[model samples]
Target: MPLLPALAVVLPLLLAAQTIEEQEWHLDALDVYSAQDQSRGDGVIVAVIDSGVDATHPDLAGRVLPGTGFGSSKGTDGTTDVDGHGTGMAGIIAANSRNGGALGIAPGAKILPIASADEKEQFALDVVAESIRWASDHGAKVINMSLGFSSSMTPSLVKAVNYAIEKDIVLVAATGNEGKEVSAPANIAGVIAVAGTNREGKPWKSSNVGTDTVLAAPAVSIVTTAPESVYSSGYAEMDGTSAASAIVSGVAALVRAKHPQMPAKDVVNALIKTAQDLADPGRDEATGFGMVNPMGALTAQFPPVARNPLLPEPKPSTTQPTPTLAAQQPVQPVVEMKDRLPFVAGVAGGTALMTGLLIALPAIRSRRREPVVSARDTPPTPW
Candidate 1:
C-alpha cells in the first residue's frame, strides 16, 4: 500500500486488559502526572479537527462541547466518529479516566469536535480551513489537527492558520505517518508540528520528519478510547503521529490553563524549550525539539512579552539627524615640529656660550697683576 493509504487503514489493536489500566508509562514519559497536580487543563477548550468524535463514548461523556461539522457531514450539530479515528484522538487529549477508562494527558480539558472528513475518511483542504476558522471563532483555545494531506500547503489553509493565530489560538498538527516528509497543515507556518516517539524515547519508524516538526510524543502501542462500534470494548491500543499530536495538544491545554494570559507563541516556545532532548542535543529533523514534557512546559517561567515574528520590526526614528559627508569624516590635529625646533636649539647654544665666558674671565683676573711685573723686570735685565 502507498504511504498515505496505509495511514488511512492504521487501526487500533485490542489489548487483553479487561478494565483499562491507565497507560501510565506514556503519561510518565510526558511528566503528565506531575503536571496534573499543578493544572489538569481546567476550563480550557481544545478543538479536535478530524473525522468527528464519538460524543457518547464512556470516557468522553460530558467532556465534549458542541461543535459544527463540515464536508460530507455538513451541519452545526451531531459530530459523530464513524471511522473511530477522531474518538481515539479525543481520548488521548481529554478522556476522564476517573470513570474507569484510560486517562488522558489532560483529563480536565473539554473537547470541541469538528468533523472535517467524510465517511470515506477523505479530508478536503477547503473544509479543513473552514473548520479551523470556525473553531477559533467559537472559543477554542487550542486546536488539534491529527489529519493532514500529503500535498503541498494550500492558500486557504494558510489563511485559516493566520486567522487562528490572530485570535491567539494554539494550533498543533501531526507530522504524517508516511516515514517521509511531514504532511501539509503541519508544514504550514505557526503550527506546532508533532512527531511520534516510542517507549524508549526514540522516533517511531513510521512517523514523518521535517524542519517544521516541533515536538515528539508516545505513538507506539498507545492505549486510548475507541468507538463502541469499532471496538465492542471501549478502549484500544493504537500507534501513529496522530496520537502524538493529540498528546501535545493536551499539553498545550495545560500550559494555557496554568498561564491563562500567556500568548500562543510563548506557549509553543515553552513546550519547545522545555522538551527533553532525545537522539540529538537540540532540535532534530527526526524528533524536532525532542519529546514533549508536560510538567516542564507548565512550570517553566517564560518572559511575559514576546514579539510576533510575522509582524515587521519597529523602524528607527525619522526625526533623527543624518550626518553630512564632512561631519562623517574623522578629524585629525596638525602639529608644527619645524617651528618649535629652532627655539629649542637657540636656548641650548646661549647656555653653552655663557658658561665658556665665565671660566676665561676668572683665570684672566687672577694672572693679570703677576704677568705685567715679570715683563718689566725681563726688559731691564736684558739692557
Candidate 2:
C-alpha cells in the first residue's frame, strides 16, 4: 500500500455521552466559533481526496456534492466510505450540525469527495494524481489530502500538484503520522504541509517534522463524524496528522469565503502569517509557524503578497543566447517565505502583517524538498 494507514485509532463514542464542548477541545483552541461568526465558509468548495465519504451521514447530508471514485469494484459515487477515514476528514472540514450533531469549522462550505484509495487504506499513486487534476478542473477552491506516501513522488504526481497550483487551488496534506520525515505530496513544493499538535498546544509526539511543514493544528482526541456501519454511534474519536490537515483545510475555506477575491497564494499567506508561533522564534519543523489561530486568520489584517510564501523562486533559463551588458545584469531572486523573514522581522518581530508592495515574487516553490526515502511493508491483501 503506497498510502499511509489510517492516521488514528477510531474509537466509537456513545451518541448521548459527551457534549460538543467535552469532545472537541481543538475547536476551543482555535476559537472556531468566533471565527465562524466572521465566515462559515459559504460559497467555498473543498475537495476531500481520500478513501471515500459517507454523504448520507447526518452531519454531512446536504453538504456533500456529487463526486467521482476510482479503482476496481469501488463502484461508489464518492458518497460511500469503505474505511470511514474520508468521512472523518470531511466531517472535520464541513460537517453541518443542523440536527445538533458534529459541527464542523466551516459548516456552510460544501464537500467534493474524491474516492481514489481503496478499503484497505491503499492508494494507487496514479489514481491520486488523476484525482488532483479532476478536482482542479471541477472548481475546487481547496483540496484536502489526509493520505500521503513516505517515498519520493512520481513525475505525474508532481505535475498534477503543479497544475492545481497554477489553477489557484489551495492544496493541504498531512505530514504523515510516523513522527519521522514529512511525506510526499505534502512535502512537494507549493503544498501546505501540516503537522499535528496536542491539546496542550505542543507538537504531537507522532507528527512528522521537516522544512516543508507550514502549520500545525490540534490532532489529539479529535471528535468527528463516522459512517454508521463503521461506528455504532455514528461518531468516532481519533488522533493523527490526518485530522490536523483537515482542520487547516476547514480554516482555508473560511479564508476563501471571507475574501472571495483573494488569490490562493494570499489565502495560504494569511494562514501562515496568522498562525501562533509555538516553536523556535519563527518557523520550526516541529510546529511550523505554530498552531492555527482561526480568529486571527479571520479578524486580523495583513497585506496580501504576490506569491505563496511556501513556494520557492524559479530557476533562470539556460538555453537563451548570451545577453548584452545591460541584459546580463544580475536579476533579483524571488523572495521566498524564509528569505523574507528579515523584512518581516524588521517591521514586526512577531506575527504582525508585512506592509508595502513586494515585486517580482515568484508564484510557487521551485525547489522540491525530498524527505529520506523508505517504504513501509504493505499490509496483506484483504482477499
Candidate 3:
C-alpha cells in the first residue's frame, strides 16, 4: 500500500521539488492593497479572462497585450499561454515583476490576453461575448474572469454580462471549483462571484458556495506558472476557483489602481462594501464578503471611474529578444538558496550529537545493570 496519491499534500515543503517558499501570506494580503491609495493604472487595460498571460514572463514583459483567443479552434494574436492557468492568473494580476520572483496584485496593471479555454460554445457564448464586447470596444477598464462554466445561464451569457455593466467594465468571475452549480458567467447579475480561501481561513473543498458568493480570496496550495513544464520546470501548484479569480483580478487592479473614476458599479460597490467579514458572520455559504481586503478596496470611500477617455488602445506589447549565445549562456539560478548553510550545519551537528548522547547515558545504564559479563558463563553447561 505504499502507492496511493489520488492527491494529498500538507505542504511543509517539496511542493513537487520546491521553488516557492516566499510565503509572506499572499504578499501580506497584497500589502493590504498596497497600503491605502496609490493607483498607478496609467493607460489602464485589464482583460485577462484566463488560461494565458506568461507572454515571455520578464515580469509580464512590457505589460502584455496582443490578446485574443477563445480556446478550441480560435487562437490568434498570441498570449494564449497554452494553459499555464491563464499565465498563473496573469501573474496574480498585473505582474510588474522585478526580474526573479513573481509579485503582481496590480503591479502597475495592463494585460488583455483573453483565451477562454476549450470545448467551445464559442468558448462559452460567442467567445465570452466577443471578449466582453472586445473589452468595451478596447479601453478595458477591467474584466479579469479567471474562467468557469458549467452551462445553464445561456441568454448569450446574460446579454454578455449585461453588456459589461453597460460598458462600465469590471466583470471578474470564477466561483466554480465544482462545489456544485453556478459558474455560467458566475451566476450572472452583473458578475463578480470569486470564492476560494486557504492559509487557515478554510473553505475550498472545491470552492463554490451558495447565493452567488462575491468575496473571499487566497485560493489553496496555489503556487503558480505551470504551463511549460519539463515536469515542474517553469513552475506549478494550482488549486481552484482559478486562483480565486486571480485574487479578485488583483483586487481589480488595486481598485482600478485608485478610483480611476469608479464605475463597474463603483468598483462592485467597493468590493462589497470593503469585505473582510469572514467566519460566516454576515454572508455565509462559505466565507463570502470576507477576505479580499486589498487594503479594504483601496481606502474604502470610493468614487472615481467615470472615464470616457475616448477609448482606444486595444493593442500593444512586443520586442526584447536578442539573447542568443545559446540563449545567453549564463543560466544557473533556478531558485534554491535557503539551504541556510544546511540548516546551520544541521543545528550544530545536532548539538554535538546530543552532547555525546548525554555523556554516554551513565555508561548505558551501567551496562544494563551489569549481570552476565562473560561468555554464557556456566549457563550453557547446565543446558
Candidate 4:
C-alpha cells in the first residue's frame, strides 16, 4: 500500500483514543514527560527556519520570539504562517499545553521563527542560508530546518551550515519526504538529518533514507499546533520527516538545557550515541543510529569533548628530556654574516663539489659501459 494511505488508515484509530491534551503521542513515545522533569529546555532558543510561524497560536503564546522574514513579503516579521507548516513545527518543539492546548517536547524552549519560504513550498537556498546566519547571530542554540529542497548541496547553504557549526549552533534538518536519498541541507555535514518513524517504531514508508540520516523520531500522524487562519481548530495531524526533525530539535534543546556549556558536536553526539536502535542493530541507512530517546539523551553520560574515530590518535612521547642545557648556558653574541662568509663559501663549494661528483659518477659509469645499437634503430636511420 502507498505510505500516505496507510498513515490515513492508522491515524483515525489513534486519534479516537486521544484527547486534545493527549494528542502529542510523539512526546510519550520519546518518553519526554520524564525528561521534562529534569529540564524543559529553559534559556535555550530554537530557530525554526521554515514558512513563518503563527505567534498568536494558543499553544505557542509568548514562546515565539521576535523573528525576521526572508520570504517574498520582505521586511515582514515572521509571525505569519500561510501554510500552517511552520506553526506545526514550532509547536512540536515548544508548545505549552498548560492551557489545554497541544503539548510540546520542550515547552520551555523559545521558538525563534525565521521565515524563509511561503505557502507554495518554494525554498530559496540563499534565503535559507541568510535565515540560518540570522538565527545563529540572534542567540539561537538550536536551528531546526524542516523545509528541504530536492537539489543536492548548494555552496551557499553549505557555507551557512558550516557557519552555524562554527558558532556552536546545533543544526537539525529533515531528510526529504521523497522516500529516496536524503536532501540538503540535511545531507550537509554536521546537520542532524532526521528520518520519520511510525507509531510502530518502523521506518515511515515515505521518509527518505540515506547514509546522511542520523536520527529517527515519531512523525506519522503527529498532532501539533497549526495556524488558526489556516487550520481552524489550531490543531492538525501531519506526517513527514519535518515533524521528526522538529522532535529531534526539541530533544537537542533538552540536551542543551541540561549541558549548557556542551559544544554543538558533543550535543549531537549525545543524542546519536544514546539513541535506541531500530531497523538494524546499529546505525543503518533507514533509521541512522535509531529512534531518538529524549530521556536517555538527557541523562546519558556524554564525553566532555568530541572524538572522531577516523582521526589517528596522537602518539604519546616515549622519552622525557632533561632540562634544556641551553637554558643554563650564557647568551652567545650574534655573528655577522660577513664574518662567516668564508665558512659559508666553503660549505657551498663542498656541497657543489659533492653534487657534481654525484652527477658525474653515474655518467662516467654509463660512458664506461658499451652501448648496444638495436637493429631497428640502424634500419630506421638507413630508411
lDDT of each: 0.70, 0.73, 0.56, 0.71
Instruction: Pick the lDDT winner.
Output: 2
Best by TM-score: 2
Model 2 misplacement above 4 A: 1-17, 20-22, 73-75, 317-383
Deviation of model 4 at 360, angstroms: 70
Compose the digit string of candidate 2's lDDT tens values, residues 106-180: 999999989886543456556778899999999899999887765556666777887888899999998877677
- Candidate 4 per-residue C-alpha lDDT over 1-383 given as tens digits, one digit per residue, 9 for 90 to 100: 99999999987666554455576677777788899998899999999987788888777887999888886745877888876678888988998874456788899999998877644434566678899999999999999988665554556677777678778898998886667787767777678889888899999887788988899998776777777675456666666788899999999999899889888878888888889999658889989999999888888886566432111234345585432222222222432322211000000111112211101011100001111212221111100
Residue pairs with colliding backbones in model 2 are 311-365, 312-365
* Model 1: lDDT of residue 112: 93
- lDDT for 23 in candidate 2 is 65
Sorting all predicted structures by lDDT, with the top scorer first, yields 2, 4, 1, 3
Tell me the tens digit of each residue's lDDT in model 3 across 1-383: 23344234433223323223243256665564354346645457888765446576655667788877654625565474543556667766766534234556676778887765454212334456667776677778888776554444545456666666667787777776656654656656657777787777677676767776777787765554433431123444455666677777777767776767666667777777787787747776666677777776777785543422112222333666433222222222222222101000000111112211101011000000011111211111100
Model 4, position 351, has a per-residue lDDT of: 12
* Ten contiguous residues with the weakest lDDT in model 2: 341-350
TM-score each candidate: 0.76, 0.78, 0.28, 0.76
Question: Which has the higher lDDT value, candidate number 1 or candidate number 3?
Answer: 1
Runs with alpha carbons beyond 4 Å of true place in candidate 4? 1-17, 118-121, 307-383
